[model samples]
Target chain A: MKDNVKLMKGNEAIAMAAIRYGCDGYFGYPITPQSEVLETLEAQMPWETTGMVVLQAESEVASINMVYGGAATGKAVMTSSSSPGVSLMQEGISYLAASELPALIVNVMRGGPGLGTIHPSQSDYFQATKGGGHGDYHLIVLAPSTVQEMADFVSLGFDLAFKYRTPSMILADGVVGQMMEKVVLPEQRPRRTEEEIRRQCPWAVTGKDHGRTKRNIVTSLELDSAVMEKNNERFQRTYREIEKNEVRYEARYTEDADYLVVAFGSIARICMKAIEDARKEGVKVGLIRPITLWPFPYDAIREAAKNVKGILCVEINAGQMIEDVRLAVSDSVPVRHFGRMGGIVPNPNEILDALRRDFIDKPANAKED
Target chain B: MTREEIIRPENKVYSRPRLIDDNYMHYCPGCSHGVVHKLVAEVIEEMGLEEKAIGIAPVGCSVFAYNYIDCDWIEAAHGRAPALATAASRLNPDKVVFTYQGDGDLAAIGSAETIHACTRGENIVIIMINNGIYGMTGGQMSPCTILGAKTATSPYGRRSDLNGFPLKVSNVVALLDGTCYVTRQAVHTVQAVRKAKNALKKAFKNAIEKKGTSFVEVVGTCSSGWKLTPEKSNKWMEENMFVNYPLGDIKDTAAGLEEKTVEVKKS
Candidate 1:
């Protein structure tokens, strides 16, 4: 393996990849499952090498506001936290979206309505895909199923974030965050020069251009109701553009299957194994793993619904993403949800059993012989 | 001298700061925000930081401060201006960063952000307008509202049982090791305005020198909120607000010009 390749946990890969991606600054607070993201950056001392500013903020609220401030200067900045901490950052996220600032936020999911278990759970699917904060806005949410994708999505998320001038999130669960796997890290990309930043983000508040340019004011406060409505219209237009262009998903064995499984993140990795086991038993189950959870593969799921008899949406949460699945499939195919909650990661055997019980054995779901 | 000669350039003694925009200010006729805004513009212009200045505007009556001050400005969520200023200054070391906030913003909602930023010794200037009440919310009680002062929330006189004393935020921050300059000044008189402008100029100089956190609390008045005329508002502040928030410097350690940087250990 090359020097860029190493065996590391997904959280470590996120830190390493951020430095390689030439991130200008990282402001975050410590949280369970994702604390290693900060620990790894501290260990690497990226400031000595790449001049990446890494500071342990006082709280998630302060960290997200720091991100808002840093993003206004047109530099690549980000923050990472677990479910509960992410909840504290919703107001800043809404401001980031409303001001059209480009920044990255990583949510390593854990079970929760309130200080739930630190173990892996996909319960934040609704929060990430739907508007997690107030107002009509969307974050470009990318779900990574493997440690390699964890490293890869740092740059990809930044690209999409800057392209749309909006916030982007890497929605990984605790399993992918803590699990160690071999990964190839990207080569170093130099941070953009101040002049380059000025050219790229002309609307950025990079100080006044003396009198040569109009002073840029970064704010979300519009007292004029009509002007605020126009701002909302512009945001809705950008979201429609994203939905039209950026839907991504991976499908397997759907060409000759009677049952489909909808899943994402690490849960999709588990369902891949379940599909293989169900196929051996002649159940013929396929998998559709959504990579981009926001521009959710609704079209792909709808296409697969035509070939399948019934769909089982397997996740670590209790019936959150299944709503999107049902919305896509509509009445054409019967859709159902099967999962465990409170941090218990369902195994392949249990998922296979769910497939048998929910589709293969259930008379209403089973196709005619 | 003739009237025309008296107004000539050679006879002129004062002019508006060129950095201030031409838009009509939204501040009430007797509000201190307009005067302080002018002083800020003057300081930034005199220091030649207009091009390299980034201002964080807070959510209060001065939330539209960006409209009056012609510089790159970012409007932060209520009380989060210090956290925002920290990142803005750290990422762009050459840029001059400052935050303008009111009592409710600085002492109430953003107290943690203010204390932590000063504790971390972030190199930014924080200009606090301690007006004693929540003027933007129509004279509601604020953390800095004095005892026995009546506000919309405190319809009856504020009692020690129901409300606490005014927060001497500048005095609190002056004791922090991270802060190099902390002062409380007012803008109600000609002498006071000059002293306040001097305090701001020193704070801005400290910020540019990377001395540490520089806090300047201006004891201001809200004529409308206080239900007093502009002249009566100034007199009321002197007799009532001055007893709680006295004018003059509380701490000035910029003479040391010490620069503290925490070194991260490399594994």
Candidate 2:
């Protein structure tokens, strides 16, 4: 583990993890902050050394489609972009989700109503956690606060995607994408054999075999409402099963802490720092970092409610993940939100102040568990 | 029990290929889609790519092209076949991939995808049929329609000032460095049909060989859109449309190879 440790940015860590984990192709367009991802891979992809293919596409739309195409061949392929670019890819993403193609998509979100700014923002929480595209489907949205989690989550994302035959996303913000941190890489796993992939994704378009008894077709179009309803039900059932098997969360100091901070992605990183600061001042504050935003750590929050008096939901957006936090806590305890929108990242000092003002100062309002 | 005595069904003699199903086409009488379909099927058969090929069918007149083409077909959003084809080809590089598009589908709304696919040199074939009118939408003015050619939108002949000049898709695609073979052919007569077939075969071959992007624009006739009888529409194409949209190879890699070698030598 020590040997695998290195200082790397979030973007580089993602690219390296994808390559080491046998991701055979990457298709992407150049976007700020995330452009380093393409640049790093472009410089290193000496076709001889790595048998993978890297293509700089003309646009985000084309890039995502390319990933769609490569994934159809039962190969692990991925693409990355910022918020506006990710919006362009929604059409393809919806198609991928509908077709049940296993692929990875990373969105280093910046502020956006339409290209609002280039800085960090968690405004895309609604888009990522709920369905971004126009369809009745969901992407397994993973949010990583640390560079190490960014790398580790990608490998896990690919695993879950292939396991369920669905598209998965690593929903990070610009701050997490651009910030540099120390990380310990994991041992490279053996590439899944083609037979294994074929066995898993039996519906993949590997060309027709004359000897096969029946042809396999992959499509999202179901003209019959009843049939489409049944398909949606099946998808929902799978999502429920995923919710059961894949909810991940981390709690720090929640055992005795009076206030709990509910956060994710880059904002969660800042909350950890705030938690540390508040603890030094004798303010009993803890942090709850959500790793999987879709299969949200509801149960974890419910359990924390047993001891924690109040929860402060912090995010880069004005309020998106706060809604989820509120839903999870469900009036069992007082829940408050602190956030900054339009690319403004909340400062650690500001969060510490919010903790002092809302929970520490107002001890009477802090409900006892 | 002799082998010679064993009898096989006569229906198996000329059995339909895997990609082509037994279904009647929805195209109008004397429309060039039948010829185009046969040419594509013939090429697919020749290259033995039927089992591996994936075809993206565009909206407009060719929306139901998937019904006739036997391969795995994906129906794309309006004018988005190129993007869909790009994904399909990139995903299945070993598989033969192509998009069957019409004038409106390729030249108008999908222009961005069409140009980008060629510019990126995506290893795919684009079969664009330019019939100078939108058949599915009841004779709307298409991007490939000639000057002074009146349709439902341009009832008093197309005005260059009011409406833009007709788009030359083959010429535009030829300008892209990624396109290895770009040609414009007509399917008016038997001789022209043979030439168009040859061009189609070359384009598919180029894609199969992984040479680069290949585009073959076929000038077809739409009698229903033209409001002319099938016989008269053939004459109209020969007399009017052919002169404006001439049939010839806009960019031929085989011919350019000599010039490229010379340039390389100089460099």
Per-candidate TM vs. native? 0.97, 0.89
lDDT of each residue in B75-175, candidate 2, tens digit only: 66667677767766765667777889999999998898899998888889999999999999899999888888989999998888989898988988887
User: Model 2, which residues run further than 4 Å from truth?
Assistant: A1-3, A189-196, A213-216, A363-369, B1-18, B28-30, B74-80, B83-93, B133-141, B147-158, B221-240, B256-267
Candidate 2 per-residue lDDT over residues A74-160, each given as its tens digit: 778899999999999898899888878889999998987887999988888999889999988888999988899889988899999
Question: Model 1: how far is A63 from its true place, Å?
Answer: 0.4
Clashes of 2: 4
Once model 1 is optimally superposed onto the true structure by TM-score, how far is the C-alpha of residue B27 displaced, in angstroms? 0.8
Per-candidate Cα lDDT values, in order, are 0.93, 0.83
Highest TM-score against the true fold, candidate:
1
Kindly report which residue stretches of model 1 are placed more than 4 angstroms away from their true locations once superposed.
A364-369, B1-6, B255-267
